[model samples]
Target: MAGGNFMGRVVSYVVNELLVNTLANSPAFQRFAVRTSKRIEDASNLAARKRQELQEQLNDSLRKFEDMSQKKH
Candidate 1:
């Protein structure tokens, strides 16, 4: 009984590993991974652009405020 159980466990592990390896190497999974990676990269670029724009706006506002303060003095 113990030997039977061991064989069963080994078979199960092999089957599961093969299934995982097959799925990982599949064309569909590869395409999905590429698309997901591209989307993440695009989103990161967009966030960086937005941050730069905000920083520029903040700088312009600060410059204007400083100019006004200089005029008052």
Candidate 2:
């Protein structure tokens, strides 16, 4: 019974080591992290583009209004 217990312990340790090593080398985990980072970058870029477009539109309208006012004056 003691020898059987010792063998079980050894098997458990080996399995644990294998799991840790496999996880550390996991390509899927790395890809997931990379994809998450790219998504964040794309989202930020999209927000910036929207903001710039809105600002340009606002500027154009303001300029047109200013020109119309000046003409009336």
Per-candidate TM-score against the hidden true structure: 0.71, 0.60
lDDT of 2 by residue, 1-73 (tens): 9999999999999999999888779999779879999999999999999999999999999999999999999
Q: Which stretches of candidate 2 lie over 4 Å from their true place?
A: 1-25
Worst 10 residues of 2 by lDDT: 21-30
lDDT of each: 0.98, 0.96
Q: Which lDDT tens digits does candidate 1 get at residues 1-73?
A: 9999999999999999999999898999899999999999999999999999999999999999999999999
Inter-residue clash pairs, candidate 1: none
> Can you tell me which runs of candidate 1 are displaced by over 4 Å?
1-20
Give the best candidate by lDDT.
1
Backbone clashes in model 2, listed as residue pairs: none
For candidate 1, the TM-score is 0.71
On TM-score, the leading prediction is: 1
Give the distance in Å from residue 63's predicted Cα in candidate 2 to where it truly belongs: 0.3
